[model samples]
Target: MLAPFLIMLREGVEAALIVGIIASYLKQVGRSDMMPAVWLGILTAVALALFVGTGLQMVSAEFPQKEQELFEALVGVVAVAVLTSMVFWMRKAARSIKGELHASVDRALSGSAFALIAMVFLAVAREGLESVFFLLAIFQQSNDALAPLGALLGVAAAVVIGYGIYAGGVRLDLRRFFRWTGVFILFVAAGLLANAVKAFHEAGLWNGLQETAFDISHILPADGPLGSLLSGMLGYRDAPTVGEVIVYVVFLAATLIPFLAPASPATSRAAARPARQKV
Candidate 1:
């Protein structure tokens, strides 16, 4: 539940931020009349995300047990890849996001209404599709209604926060917010990687390394509530296979080393300037 909640909140906030930037740009340029098209595009993207999620869920449900495990493994792998890219991409792109958004708005306004709509659709749909994929992966891991409920709450909270930002009632340290969340997401992705490996092993797709690296089942079984939470969030395993342990450790270490590195002096100065200006 916690994992899904945080994931959805982060993803929702990202989408909201993009939409807010576009809307703010439109208003600033005296093109408020085109606002309807922006909303239309957002709606379309959201609908498409829901349709895709539902379709995937229905399709996966129809598979036999082994096939279901294989499906889960595939989804987990894809989610880890998508999320890893998203975190790094956002880190690189965050500095220029506002400028890029404004440029996009300018391009859209200069083009025909259809083009403008298409631009907005593409922007929102990018985030929407990401959310769909992540949620699918999470649901496969959770298999509980609570996870979806938590996600709904997270999205609702994001909407409220986004509205506050748009109304000038609140301000965010977006760089810090994203940095911390990105770190957390890396851990989650590591867990997903381990889970994916376990699923593949269970499906008999891989059997090269099936020995239990260590057994802690006596202290904490993976099926226990706390163990399950850790398993879902941090890839904890009571008696993990050698392959699962290797994937979890190697992925986490590789991704986190660069992520935890201090920002370069130039990057730090550049990030600081905006906050100083805001102050």
Candidate 2:
């Protein structure tokens, strides 16, 4: 529950931030009349995302047990890939997101209303698709109704926080927030990768690699509350298969090293300027 909550909170806050920036910019430029189109596009994106998630869930429910495992494994792998890319993309794009958004908005306004609508739809839909995919992967792992409830609450909280920020009622250290959250997400994705491999093995897609590396089930059962949290957030399997362990270690090592490396000097300077000005 806590895991889903945090994941959704971070995702929701990001979507909200994007929308808020667009809206704020529109207002600033005296183009508030076009705001309705943006809202419509956003609503459409939300509806489409919900439809896709529900449809996939229903379709997957009809599969046989083994097939279901395969489906879940596929979803887990795709979600991990998407989420990992998203984290890194955001880190790289954050510096120029405002300028890019403004330019897109300018182009949209210059084109037909349909183009403007498409712009808004694409922006919101990108985030919506990401959230739906991630949630689907999480739901498969959790198998608990409470996880969705937690996600809803997270999104609600994020909305409030986002509104506060946009309204100038709150100040956030956004760089710190994203940096910590990115690290957390990296661990989560690593766990998902390991789980994906386990699922594949269970489905007989992979064989002869079923050795258990170690059994810590006596000390930390994965089903326990703390263990579940860790498992959900950081792939903490108590008795992981050798393949799963290898995948987890490799994924973390490959991703984390580059992520922890120092940023380009120019990028560092640009990131620092906003905080310095704010201070």
Off by over 4 Å in 2: 266-279
lDDT (Cα) of model 1: 0.85
- Angstrom error of the Cα, residue 147, model 2: value is 0.7
* Best candidate according to lDDT: 1
Clashing pairs in 2: none
Over 1-279, each residue of candidate 2 has an lDDT whose tens digit, in order, gives 777788888888888888888889889889999989988888999999999999999999999999999999999998998889888887877776777777788888898777767888888888888888888998887655688888899899999989998899989887778777888888888888888898888898987568999998999998898887787667688998889988988998998888867799998788656534432
Every model's TM-score: 0.92, 0.94
Cα displacement (Å) at residue 84, model 1? 0.6
lDDT of 1 by residue, 1-279 (tens): 787788888888888898888888788889999999998888988999999989999999999999999999999998899899889888877876777777777888888877778888888888778878888888887645688888898899889888888889989998898899999999989988888998998888988788889999989998888888887677678998988889988998999888878779898678556534432
The local distance difference test score of each candidate is 0.85, 0.84
Q: Report residue 159 deviation for candidate 1 (angstroms).
A: 0.5
Q: Which stretches of candidate 1 lie over 4 Å from their true place?
A: 265-279
